[model samples]
Target chain A: MSNIIRFIIKYNLVFFFLLFEVFSFYLLISYNQHHKETFLKSSGNVTASLLQLSSGFTDYFSLKEANEELSRENAYLRTLLPDNKIDKEIDDIYSIMEDSVEYIYRPAKIINNSVNRLHNYITLNKGERDGINRGDGVISARGVVGVVRYTSQNYSTVLSLLNTQLKISAKLKESNFFGTLEWNGKSYQHAILSEIPAHATVSTGDAVVSSGYSTIFPEGILIGTIQDYELISGEGFYNIRVKLSVDFKNLTYVEAVKKINKKEQLNLENRTLND
Target chain B: MISSLGKYIVNFIIIILAQVLILNNIDFGIYINPFLYLLIILSLPVNISNWLLFTTGFITGLIIDAFTNSIGLHASATVFLCFTRPYILKYFAPRDGYEPGSLPVPSHFGNAWFFKYILIGITAHHFFLFFTEAFTFTDFTTTLSKIVASTIVTSLIIMIAQMFGKRNKRR
Candidate 1:
């Protein structure tokens, strides 16, 4: 017993060092698992709320720019109101259709965001109370931003489009050849569009937009324009680089898309698969 | 000794506040993040005990982690820095050994020697931080470049801050 006591006293620092390392690693694993879970609670919520308080101070500096973006978005949305000529034309053609109100857009302010990391996230000021929920699509005035990942009572976290885990369905505006948009973890302004067939006629300036095949986003929302593309030998797909339209560095205000019939549609699809 | 203790307390608060509130907000594109908070650890009294040093590193990192939402990245890296600090100090030890109760600032030991020490410590911290945050070498070159750029920027900031620390001590 004395020998053991003497050994511990002699190497106590090393033991402490090892103990702290284990504690840190434990924190790392648990925190990452919490982030990975569909709904983050506890520590994530506390930190996100703290970030909300800090962003309140820093969010003022960008008000002018944010105001300009919001006004531009308002003008665009005004042109799409039900009384607009385009809608009247559509109403004339589809006299029997009343499902046009499938999606609703709720405006929210981004309280905190980070783009420097591999798995980037954006925290918005709206959450469950504001009708926001997980898996809903979020778009800025310029383009698609991300999908909601976690929601607290008053704040929500977005799985940014830049995240490696997020694969957005995108298509070329000209040819309508669809592909998956993914970030290469390099530049925020650029993402790669893959799975495009080699025969698709792609150019540096071709527009890329959301496919809307998934219930998250409506059809034809702008994503970006193609920067370049290549066809590797023996590969059946074209690798295209897209220049993202949304300036993630300046993303502030966004709209959360609410698909009213999303639950019914998912249920129907699941039933079909089960059958 | 009491005055020195008070000075350290003031420094600890200032460094943590500046790092979390100001420096973390300054995003110089994705490559260069200046970790000025490590300066708090870098400037500890030279003859401090290993256990105290490690604890200081862990606490400093934990506070930064809580603010940044980065979890354990800073905490682990700072602990790693504390572990290697003694060896670094031994290598850069003066011919006559360290002066009791002295700081590791450039004023106490000339600019060249202090710069070397800061460079080594900051490089270790930044390398561990950037790589561990990445958790993969899938894009090896970019991560390496990020670590290199961040190391240079952080070292420069520390050197300039040390210069100020020197001036303040003279007063």
Candidate 2:
């Protein structure tokens, strides 16, 4: 009818605004709901390839720092094994056990990363083609970084530990009293370690590391050093502040961890839980 | 010089690149995130079509989201900015109002008006963006601090950007 046309013409701008808002909100909610189903497909290949192009230029500036980090990690690894005593024997043992190694590390460059957002994510240059897959743990030379959330054929995204949604299983290295580590959306330097029993002996400067209870990370990867702690009387838990080790600001290189028998481990856990 | 439309298109590309490549990599730490990309939206002509403005806002946000890997977060916030922009213009409009087809920039509107414009617009945009990214008002103080600090940083950057490229109105 002409009346309807007139109505539309009179309020078309408002109608257009509403329409766009609804459409975009749908894109937003659908993304949050179907993250595993469609996120990579929606912004997957094309975006990552472009980010790779840009990171190519930026990666040069951080090479020295990355090299220093790699060498530091190498030095720590060296101290783990004294040089002259048993190098050849250990090498032979490593090769023999390679087939059944529990965790495999694949080096990848970070093509895109952000820390300012509440729910931050990092994108790496490696993906399914490189044997990286969803739910795999990612770590920098310094410490645990995040877990792979989605993967394209040649690119993948990590849900950075800085993200509010991610909860890393961490324990105090001193007493091995474990808790869940979470970001408070406050700063990149710190995260909150909750679920620690109030009675645990925690102190400032105590070290925190991955508990390995979550099969994603191997036992004893350093997460950070604790900065502070306080007891919540009613909750009967201590809120410990951890100073993260990995400098997300200059994060450029990382390794994706693939558990060789993760499938079997997860299935066993699920089967037990189902009962 | 190219036409104003061409200029806007060029600005659209440059601002996005600067945001994703340069500004994003600057590592201003947790407090100061400068969003100069809003320059493209804020500089849109006063009397442009509503539908076009909204679509442009959405597309700009979607592009940023694509690079950053948060598919709809920026798009949602930018759309909200576009929807409220006209009313913001009205609230801070000159008494006689904006000349038709004239772009909103400091050179055209004077520094005071333009600064106020950027202040209001960037505050709303950053608040919507940071909160939605947070997805909850539970930790209101930290989120508010981020919004406040980021808005200040973004406003100054935008104002500094406007200080350059003075328009030669007499010519």
Candidate 3:
């Protein structure tokens, strides 16, 4: 018994290291599929609220720039509102349908942002209490910014467009051709829009906008313009570089978009896939 | 000197909090996350048992892992560092040998020796971390660049931390 005890004591360090490694390996395997610890995944409600309070104190200096952007967007919308002749023709036909579509915007400030990382996430001031929820779309006046991932009472985290996990459906403004926009984590100023078929007439400065296939964002929200592109040799897809509309480094304010029928649409899709 | 038990507990909490709250947020255009927590392992007393050093390192890293969503990356890297630390220290041991009950801080070893010790240990830690995080040599060039950038930044931060400790001691 004494010999066994001495042997265990002598080799305890190796035993402990192996034990820890085995435990860590188990966690790594589990975390690879899906993170299990929800508590540590994000800051909880209390911490998020504290962050929101802190952001309010810090955001005062940027009010002028935010106001300027808002007024400019207001003026642009006003100009379009007066020229309703084209919209009136479309409304006449759409009036026959029962459901009318409209969108509401919830203004929020960006509390923190990181663009250079492969998996960047942004935090915004608005949260569940302010009508933000997981899967809601967020955008700045410049373009689409990201989608809401987790929300607390007073703050929400966004999976930024620059995150490798994010893939948004975008298309050329002048053509039906579309592709998935993904960040390569190389630069904040550029991203790659892949899977664009070679047959599409893509150019250096073509406009890209949301496809509106998902309820998170409305159709025609400006995403970016292609900066450069190349057709991969022997492949049918084009790797298009896009200049993002939102300057991630200087982003201050954003608007959260809530789609009224998103839950219903998602449920229907899930059921169809199950069949 | 603070008891080893108390020091270990305090260092464990400090490193985990600092890594998660502060260093993890520093993007710096590259993946240059300073794992300053390894300083705890590097600064263990010279007379301490090797087994204790290894245990402390593993625990410190496991706490870090629990916070960052990166499962065992920190744990494995830290364990590797603890394993290599004794060899590195022995290679750099003074001709007269280490002073008894002496800690590994700059005050005991002087700035140059302390700096070298930290640099070697942190390099090993970062190398293991990045390679494991990448888990592939597919982007070998990119991984190599990240390893270099992160090492430079981490070494600078560790030196700055040492300087801060020295300045505080004078105060």
Candidate 4:
């Protein structure tokens, strides 16, 4: 027993090293789950605030670019408004008659962003205090950005569309043929659109937009344009490469979409299915 | 001893800031990522015990991981490097071994010895980090490219930093 104790004591450092390594591996495996829960991600208060502080310093350098994007978004939003009194009357009537859930857009700044990882996440300055919640859809002025995965009091973590685990329901604008949009983990500006029927006419530069099958995003939000595509022999689906519209590397501002009546709609759907 | 402790703490904060703010945002193409934060582990005193070395490595890595959302990848890689550090030092040591209270900076150790030491340490670190991040060998070529490119880039940056840092050597 004395000899065994001596042996163990002599190699205690090795044992401690192994223990710490095992603990790290445990964290890696548990946290890298397929669905990768957002509990321990970058939205933690300290890290989030640190990121925001750094961004505050860096945002100054990009003032010109940011101003351009904001004005462009302003011009687009102006076009979306009713330009005539007749259209305004019709829009008011349409909104009142349509007793449906509406998705409200809340603007937020992206404090930290990454595009060079298998699972890229973006940190936004808006959080629970700004009414940003988990599952809110985030988009840029040009197109889709990501989904809000975690939130603290003043910040939120968005699981970017570039992540491998994210799949968005998308459809072609020309044929309305729908498929799933996925990131190939190679390039930040491109994603893969799969499951479109091989027989569907897919040409280069074809527009792909959200199908609204998932309540997270509204219908017809632009995702990308088809860069190229190939149909594998005897396969039912076309393998398509799409050039994403949103420039993720240059993303500074985004809007978190909050659906006001989603819960009620889901409950109603569930009740009808039960009957 | 108290001054040395304060220096290490300050070094820790500086390295973490450089890493999380500037280095993390660097896009040297898709394959290259420069992790200059490993300098924290490399510059520690030669006489520190094995367990303290490992703990410091873990703490440094945990900070980077928390900021980058990489979870345990950095921590595991840094710990592995720490566990292997002593053996590497032993193999490269001169006849009398490393001088006490001396840092592993190139100014004290000479260019050739420092190059070999840091290359090995950084290579081990980048290899473990990229492989763990991929978590699979299915994309063997892609992972290999990343490991090689990043290792070279990180080693070059560390060498440059060491060259400039030679001026600050304490007698």
Candidate 5:
């Protein structure tokens, strides 16, 4: 017994090392699924607060560019708004008319962004407190960015358009042809639009916009235009190159689109799919 | 003892912050992240007990794992390296016995010995880390490439860190 005790004492270091390693291995295997303890997953509050403080100082430097974007969007929206005189005349002509147009844009700033990664995620300065939630579509003036995946009180993360997991339904504006826009993780400026039927008359410089198939984004948000295309023999789909409208390398600010009736539409679609 | 403990704590915080804030965010096309926290393990006092070394390594790795959202990757790799550190020192020890309280750094050990020690320790840590993180030998070639690339990058960073640290200590 004394000999065994002495041996154990002699090799206690090795035994402790083995024991700790085995325990760690057990944790790894047992939690096979991604165990996201959100509290510890992100930067701590103090660090995040410090980052936010620094970002605030940096944001002030970009006020001019941000104002330019806002004014440009404002000018575009002004063109869409009908003249007040025409609206009054039309309302007088039709007493029972109903307003049929509504638009909502939630402004958000990019707190952190990376364009050169395979699975890059952009962190935004808006979150649940600012009415931004998961599945909300994010876009810049140049094109569709991505959908929000996760959110915190003061921040949200968007799966960038350059991610392989993203698939946004898009259609060629000139023709009725449409396909899914997917990033191949190669270049940020280019992506692959697949599933376009080979028979469609698609050409270079053709406009591509959102198909409105998903409730996250509204119809007709600009995605990109076709740059190049190839028809594979014996395959029904066309492999088309797309030049993305947004310059991901220079991304600074974005707008999160919140569809008011998203839940109702999703529930209805779920019921139909079930049936 | 108290000053050493304080130094270790400060080093622990600085390494982790540098890793997550700067290094982790660097996506250099391929996943060749440099894990420099192992310097803490490699810089311990020569006469420190092995159990204390292992425990310190395990805790340091656990702190990193907690921040990076990996369950046991850093912990496993660190334990593996810490377990082997004594054997490596014995294999490469100088003809004259190591001086008491002499810390392991490039200046204390010659450049060749320091390089050898750091290369082996970082390689062992990265091999076990990438292997378990990938969790497969199915794509043996790809995994091997990752191991090689990551090991090279990690070793370079470790060496750079050692130089900087040694210079700072001289001040």
Candidate 6:
């Protein structure tokens, strides 16, 4: 017992080192599931508050640019107003409106964002208090941004589109044929659309848009344009390179899209699977 | 005068704030992420015990992970960094040994030794981090390139900062 005690005491430093390393690896393997709220579970509020504090000061430098962006978006929206259309004869003056509102868009300012990491996240100033929730799709007027993953009472984190772990359903606007769009973790300005068949007519400068096959984002949001493509040696699918429309580096404001009937859709899908 | 521990505390807060607020947000492209927070670990006093060293590395990395949302990636790499630091210090020790309270900064150690120390330390940390992040040997070359590029950038920044830092009066 004395020898054992002495040996244990002698190796205590090694034991501490092993213990912490094992603890860290445990956190890595168990909590770092990419989709989970590992970091958010513990010190999220503290870190977020610190970020909010810094962005409070730094947001001034970008005020002019953000104003320009807002004005540009406002001008585009004004062009879509009914008043802008030619005064055509009100055909059936009461023509039934097609497709009622399916999504709720809440504007949010980004407080923290990064594009240089293999997996990146964006922190927004809106959260549960502001009606943002997990799984809400984030989009800029320019393009699709990301999906809200974790939310506190006053802030939330979005899984940026630049992350390798996020796969978005996108379609070639010309052909309407869809495939999985994913970032290659190499460039923030580009993403790859895989699994598009070779038979499909895809060409450079062809537009890519959100397929809206999921409950997160609505259909037809512009994603990017096809920059280039090539057929895989053995696979019939064409791998397409798309230049993303949203310059992530300059992302200042975004909107979180809350699908109104998401619960019903998910529940109905689960029931169908059960049936 | 501020105590030594107080100085380390001040260094920790200042470095972390700069890292999370400014450095992390820099769009320096994919190949040039310089983990300046490594300075927090690099600047510890020479005579600190093994347990203190490990705890400091683990906590510092975890705080960074919290800010960046990478969770355990930085923590694991920093632990590995701490695991190797004492060995490097021992192997590179001068004949007279490290003074009781000296730091690893260029002002305390000579330029060559500080440069070598930070280069090796940052490379080890960056290698483990980038490779673990890639998680597959299939992209061995890509991860290798990222590790090499990031390590060099991080080392250069430290060297330049030291050059600009006020030269401490020689003991």
Give each model a TM-score. Answer: 0.83, 0.88, 0.79, 0.89, 0.73, 0.89
Q: Candidate 4 overall Cα lDDT vs. reference?
A: 0.83
Chain A TM-score of each candidate structure, as shown: 0.78, 0.85, 0.78, 0.82, 0.76, 0.84
lDDT per residue (tens digit) for residues A1-275 in model 1: 99999998887767767877888878888777755552323126666666667777775666756775775466346345673334334443223122455566777888777677677778787889877899999997798999997787888878899887689999999999898999988888999999999888888998999998888987788999989888976989999999999999988778888666898999999999999
The sequence of per-residue lDDT tens digits that candidate 5 reaches over residues A160-189 is: 898766888988888868788899756778
Colliding residue pairs in candidate 6: none
Native interface contact recovery, model 5: 0.44
Query: Looking at candidate 4, what is the lDDT of residue B149?
Result: 89
Off by over 4 Å in 3: A1-8, A22-32, A35-37, A45-104, B1-27, B35-37, B47-83, B95-100, B167-171
* Model 4 lDDT per residue over B42-131, tens place: 888888887799889998888888888778889999998888787788888889977787778787878888889989998888888988
Report the C-alpha lDDT of model 6 over B34-151, residue by residue, as the tens digit.
8888887877777778789889999999988888877888999998888778777888788999888777877877889998998899988988899888888887788888889899
| Pairs with steric clashes in candidate 5 | none
Off by over 4 Å in 4: A1-4, A34-40, A61-101, A265-275
Badly placed stretches (over 4 Å) of model 2 are A1-4, A37-43, A61-98, B165-171
The most accurate candidate by lDDT is: 4
Chain B, per-candidate TM-score: 0.95, 0.93, 0.88, 0.95, 0.92, 0.92
Where model 1 places Cα greater than 4 Å from the true spot, the runs are A1-14, A33-100, A267-275, B1-6, B167-171
Could you give the CAPRI-style class of model 1?
acceptable
CAPRI classification of candidate 6:
medium
Each prediction's RMSD to truth = 5.1, 4.0, 5.7, 3.9, 6.2, 4.9
Between the candidate structures 1 and 4, which one is better when assessed by DockQ? Answer: 4
Model 2 RMSD, rounded to 1 decimal: 4.0
Expressed as tens digits, the lDDT of each residue in A1-275 for candidate 3 is 99999998887656666766676666666655563434433335544554455556655666756775784465334223422222333343224211333444577777666665556777776788877888899988789999997777777788899887788988889996877888876788888899999999998889989988888887888998999999998999999999988888888778887666777889999999999
lDDT of 4 by residue, A35-91 (tens): 465455678888888888888787676584776477446533523444212223335
Clashes of 3: 0
- Model 3, B1-171: lDDT tens digits are 466567557656766666656676566775566677777788787777867877777777766654443456677888888777777888888899887877777887788887788888888888878777667778788878887887878878777866755643431
